[model samples]
Target: MSLTAGGPRRDDFFKVPGKGAGAPVKPGEKAPVDRTAALSVGAFQPVVAAVPMPQRLFEHERERAAARAAGEDATRQLKNVGADVDVALTTAVLLLRGVEHPKARERVVGAVPQLAEAADYRPLDAAADFLGLDHEDAAEILEELTEHGVAGPIAEAAVRVEELRAQVQQADHEQLDELLEFLLPVSALISIAGAAAPLGALTEGDPHLAEAAKAGVVGLAAVALQELHSTEHPNVELESTELLEALTPPVR
Candidate 1:
């Protein structure tokens, strides 16, 4: 497939007007007229006013605001989920620590550090190394605990943590979709304005139009940057599944 070419280079419009070497004017010479200002005063303002701002731009702003609020809510929910997971894991580990079976108790107690590391978002492989317990070992340990009839609470807690983890992932995906909905239209508008800059300069001989096009590009860039700064990435990897599995007892 053919690749699309890139947009105009930065030098096309961002050049300094009088910085390069040029002949020095005599002291008596008249200053050159600022044609951009002249064009704006003469004819550009009326044409600009005739084309009112599109209603969709307003809609994009509203959607972006809503998405931002939703993302904040999601963040709050994630923190609360983490807190709940901490509590549940703590309770389960405490229960396991009291079990009389030597092998099961040793395995569960040994996994405490790994469980804590996972909860804190450490890499799964790194955390798993603490007890040398892969998922299969975890499953065997869980089965042994179930045979002793002490795994009920741990299993229930793991189920709850898993459910909460699913919710976090879903929220992240939804927030990303909302953010994309806002960005795509704004990006399209910037591309349109950028394309118009050269046409305004070369075809219409209107410095005012060119300036407006440049201003449009700059303004949209600011808007996009502000939104990005204010908003979190939609797919923030919580690494929560690792945490869930770290403490999770196998299903019957």
Candidate 2:
């Protein structure tokens, strides 16, 4: 009944090896690997960084935006809160006197839009009537005010200035230089008087104006970078570097 020396019919001695759905390997042979079994399939998950973003950038932008908004709110408050007539009128008188007083310039630049709208005044026309000046002169003044972030009336004034400059055809750069020099203090004052956003309004609008504003912005940026490098203003140094990078011309 036995085949060879041992009997094969005993349930205890008979071993049935377990294998996957494929063919089973003999005792002396290596089992064939099911690659599919070894492999895993599910949703593809791309490797991503678990690293956090630098907090400096977010903080810097937030602070700058807040400062700008506060400056805007302050301007609105000036309009809403009725000011003392004597003090306000005295301030207006000082502006018309044509001296480069920083406070006077700030007040005038801010009120320009309101005054112009109320009087239905075209800036070039108003300047010519009041100061006996032409279009080139008016545009120069508009540029000055715009550089200080006195935007709305400043923009309106700029339109009239452009009209006048167009009529003249020829411009006087000498006058523009003179005006810029006189108004530089006012521009600086306005920037400092408000929040910490750099005097950005100077570079707003066209490439031409941006070019003109570049020198001042660059100079200030350089100083800021220097100061920040020495101290801790959170992201001041980083922001300075970003400013420089932004100001750099792109490669063709």
Candidate 3:
């Protein structure tokens, strides 16, 4: 951006000689100019009408008023458990629509707690943590995917995570860690599975296993490697399926 002088331009400061002014004087004397008779004109005028605010500011104030009303309505609805349910559903719909607009998203995020309270919906603290990590990780993955290409499941998973994060408001530390541990392994496994499905050679002799191993897919890859070995790599098979059988979701 170019730097502009602090005040009015040179054209604005230049004063023209007016009628009934004194005669032009020599070097030491004053010029014959009528100061009082001068009409000053600026090079540029303020295009905006001073009385009315900018269109965006006006709309912002209007939206703020609507958001305030919505908050009050939410508070009132929350007092009645039955009504709160309806309000929560309505808020969810609004939030889904508003996600396309950042300002609207901000408004909806601010109202989430009130909506939950009004609806008597138990706020899952764990869900909040999930949202925060999901947002950060998804943003990173998006940046990576921009470079890596969006042809695979990893890209799709990142998109899904981004969508989920947009809905959150109150994520704290402990809940976030739990969510990360739950999500990473599962999503990494899914991504590897997706990578392995097409053009088998491109993914290596065992595309699924290779992708899983590449993504560090916990022990799920090992189980999948064992199960599918007979079809694709009969020479390398699991000694026992007991490890796969014992795998269970961790108790929360």
Best by lDDT: 1
My TM-score estimates for the predictions, one after another, are 0.20, 0.18, 0.17
**Candidate 3 ranges with C-alpha deviation above 4 Å:** 1-163, 167-170, 194-252
Those runs of model 1 whose alpha carbons end farther than 4 Å from true positions after fitting are 1-176, 196-200, 228-252
Span of 10 residues, lowest total lDDT, candidate 1? 1-10
Evaluation by lDDT, superior candidate among 2 and 3: 2
Model 1 agreement with the true structure over 46-146: per-residue lDDT tens digits: 43333222223333333444545666444544343333322322222222222334543445444434332333322222222322225443333334433
lDDT of 2 at 141: 47
Better of 1 and 2 by lDDT: 1
Q: Each candidate: what lDDT?
A: 0.30, 0.27, 0.24
Off by over 4 Å in 2: 1-98, 116-119, 129-132, 149-252
Best by TM-score: 1
In candidate 1 the C-alpha lDDT for residue 91 amounts to 25
Tens-digit per-residue lDDT, 31-65, candidate 3? 43221122222210121111111122223323433
lDDT of 1: 0.30
Give the lowest summed-lDDT range of ten residues in model 3: 1-10
